[model samples]
Target: MYFIPNENLDPTLNLAMEQYILSGLNLDEEILFFFIDRPSIIVGRHQNTIDEINLDYVKAQDIQVVRRLSGGGSVYHDLGNLCFSFILPFPNQPVPDFSSFTEPVIRALRTMGVPAEKSGRNDILVEGAKISGNAYYHNKFGTVCHGTLLFNTDLTVLARALNPKPEKLSAKGVQSVRSRVTNLNGYLPGIKTTVEFRERLLSEIARDAKTIELSDADLANAEGIADERYRNPLWTFGTSPKYTLKRTRRFPIGEIELRIEVRDNIIRDVVFFGDFFTSQEIDPIVDALRGSELETGALTAALRSIDWKAWFPTIQEEDFAAFVAQGD
Candidate 1:
């Protein structure tokens, strides 16, 4: 096994570097690497970034958002959080097991007296509180398993950043569950800084491991990939599969449920169902929203252009705009 050092703190660059290394995999060698990124939220390859985040909060806080190569739930990372990756040749095990990939981490934590154990499907818990979450990706050449380890992360920001669906929250049986997570710093009184925690963890995992250096060409390729793909908004926020966006709001007038089928960043269809009273037919308003850009300004202008008071006298144009663009 070889230990590769990551020098960049950009989430996009780090994810690009992981892919770059994974693509250059040799069947005989495995590589281990870890990095700390600035405040960011990384969504799984199969997840909808918009659906996983509070867009208003993310934008206001200016947090970096990116899509990762592995499929798993969204995770928040900051300088206090450490992310580790292992790119290894295909395992001989017939049925892939997460434990095989996570046991090393568990061992490392246990050695530090953290009492870490593999819990549920793909998480490491410290005294029944989660400290790590893992995700995996497999290709013809090898398997890449990577995850986040919370050392001294800002739990408050993490809680507000991820906007999981009701079903997912209920399934996990923990609503507003950031409190269920614990940081290694709390357990390791000896460690003064996150940097210390990272070095110690790496030391435990990479005992007498060979250090490998990436050539300039390798780095440039990774940077180029980051700029062209990982950093692009299309991959981060716009590549979600076709999905229905449902938003329900209780206006002073009545309750309204807005259902929209969005495709390729366009509103393909829209329906408004509610107990709200209207004098004129709402078909025109629905048609106006159809084929329109899923943008607040455009939707607002469209609504303002029509005599919408005949349909919804109690609501304001800005409210309609906010409702459609809120992405709730």
Candidate 2:
């Protein structure tokens, strides 16, 4: 095992660095890196960015929001927070799981007198309150397990920055969007500061581990990746799989709430729920929309093929196509 020092503090660059290392690792190599982001919220790969965050609040705060390549819930990061990432080679078949990858963190915190344990799905809790949240991304080269450790994070900002929609949380079986989290700063009163805690954790993990440095080529590759993916809006916000696209149009009858699920450039399913009155059932129109492509041209063509006017007499086919083409 080897320790790689953190060279950048930008959330986008650090995420890109993680991807570069995880994808470029050799089969026999294992590396650990520690970093901190300057006030950011990282959304999971499969999460709906529009649902996970309050855009107005985020823009008002000027907090950086980036999407990670891993699958997990969104997390808030600040200068006071410390993040850890591990890239371990799995030469044999590796069943991607959280408990095994979180061992080092559990051990390190336990050594620091904090009773940290792997809690429900992907969190590390201390005395029933969470201190860490983790996620994983795997490739043939290696597996990367990265997570956030709230050492001395600002709870107020953490609360305000993350605005997960209540309905979406309930859909995931989460009771509340607010996390029952605690900071390591309060738990380790003996430790003077967050820097001391970081060093102590490093000491626990870096024992007998080689120290390595990122070469110029590695930095260049990471920078390229950051520019191409992390800093790009398409990747950060446009890649969310699950989003509720709602279109409300007032007709002579009543209002229509056209909610749809568009994923992988395909319209997977849609539900037209509203107080509008219809003589004929809208099941056929809804059935026709299933598995339809998301592009405006393709969708317009598909809608033209269907006689939707009979079901939604007041709403035109163009309006339906336009509504379907609303979101990213």
Candidate 3:
């Protein structure tokens, strides 16, 4: 196996690099890649971004939100987190075996005195508390099994940034996100920093592995890929599947209810019902939103373009836009 080093802190570029490596490279032996991203939220491919994250908090905290190629629940990443991926040739088996990929990491953790065990389908837990969440993507070229290791992650920000559905939390029998997760820091007695822990883990996984460094041309290509897809809002938010959103907010004037139907992240239909007084026709408001993209900026601009004061004189366009788009 060979190891590739990714020192970039940008999550979008990191994902782009992963794509470049997975599809662009012609590989014979397996490849191991590791990286750490600055504060960011990476959502699953099939998940609705509006439902998975606290949009207002994510925006206010200046956290980059990117959708990954794999399918899994959303996860928060910071400098304290370490991410690892293994790119291997397609196996001949009928089903993808996750244990084969996660066993090595679990063994490495156990060797380090951390009681790590594979939990459920794609999670690694320590003492029944989750420390790692994993997902994978397979293509004609190969399969990429990747996951996050919470070396010393910020549980506070993670809990605040992730907005898992109430049913999801209830099904897990956990009250809060922080209650179900733990950092590896408590288990490692001597490891002081995530960097040091990363090196230690790497040594255990591939001590004799060859190292591959990215060339300038490779980086430029990855950056182009990042610009084309990873950094594009269309790919990050617009790729969501068709869904209906019903949001009700109570203002001082009255109670407002909005039922929006979105397909491919574009609003297809919108219905407004409320006790609020209106001096103008409501058709224009619904028309303005029907074709708008279900994103913060797009929804806000669509609402601001119309004379909202003529409808709800007490409500602000920005606030209503946030409510409509974020579903918070």
Candidate 4:
């Protein structure tokens, strides 16, 4: 692991750095890098960005949003959170799996006196609280597994930034999302400052990196990729398709009537004309939903499979689906 303190801190440039290191690094040698960025919302590779972020809250705070090459739920990052990426060579396997790749970083955290462990499907937990979550991308050449360490992130800001409302499409750690989650500072209070946390982590992980610097060519290539896609809306929002649906359905506890739009067969825009405390951004699912084909069943059938009874126990999937499936 090597400390790559980035002077060029724009998220657009940083994402390009990750892409460059993952693709250009010498895979024969194991390399881990420590990265820090300004406030940004990173969306998963397959996730609908519109559904993940609270755009109004983000714009008001001047936070930048970037789509990563890997897939997972959206995560908020600031200098307070330390991000790490591991690029490993996949030899005979020719590709990386979730288990083998993430182990190194998990083990590293244990050395940091954090007692972090892998829990659920793809998360690293500290004392049953998730301190780090990760996702990956793999090719025949190698794999890049990157994740974040919430050492001392502004939790109140993170909560407001992530704002897990609507109770729909949050498949990862449904329980944690609906409840109170903590940052690492709660566990390691002494290292409360973000810079101190970053340095300590860098000192621990630096033992693994061969300590090579990026050449001018590498920086140029990274900047080129960032300019081409990282800065473009077409590569970002345009990647998601659009669809719409509308219906009226009711439940014993609550009810809804909605006209929705979907893209790429996923909920993109949703407008609830009925009574619900849903956030206004549900419009993305409704508006983008037009002409959208169900990945399975009409809106009602798909909704039934989701056990919202646990979270929004008062709401019924049928009513929500009716509103979702109505328009198209």
Q: State residue 160's C-alpha deviation in candidate 2, in Å.
A: 0.6
Using all chains and alpha carbons, the TM-scores for the candidates as numbered come to 0.72, 0.71, 0.73, 0.68
**How many backbone overlaps does candidate 1 show?**
0
The number of the candidate with the highest lDDT is 3
Per-residue lDDT, model 4, residue 102, is 59
Model 4 spans with C-alpha error above 4 angstroms: 1-7, 25-27, 89-94, 163-178, 206-208, 239-328
Q: Which ten residues in a row have the lowest lDDT in candidate 1?
A: 272-281
lDDT, candidate 3, 242-275, per-residue tens: 3499887656543456778888999998765443
Off by over 4 Å in 2: 25-27, 167-179, 239-328
Candidate 2 RMSD to the real structure: 11.6
Q: Which rank order by TM-score, best down to worst?
A: 3, 1, 2, 4
lDDT of 2 by residue, 1-328 (tens): 8888874789999999888877764526678888888999998764556766788989999999998876667899998789898887673545456777688889988888888999766779888777888877665666778888989899878887887555444534655544667788887888776667778888987777788788889899999999999999988777423445765554444434566787787878776543344434466777778788877777777777878775555666766677677632
Q: Please give, for residues 150-242, the per-residue lDDT of candidate 1 as tens digits.
A: 999999999898886665555556777586787888889999877788789889998787888888988999999999989999977764333
- Estimate the TM-score for candidate 4: 0.68
TM-score of 1: 0.72
Model 1 clash pairs are none
> Residue 204: error of model 4 in Å?
3.2
For candidate 3, the per-residue lDDT at 231 reads 94
lDDT scores in order: 0.79, 0.75, 0.83, 0.63
Q: Against the true structure, candidate 4 has what lDDT?
A: 0.63
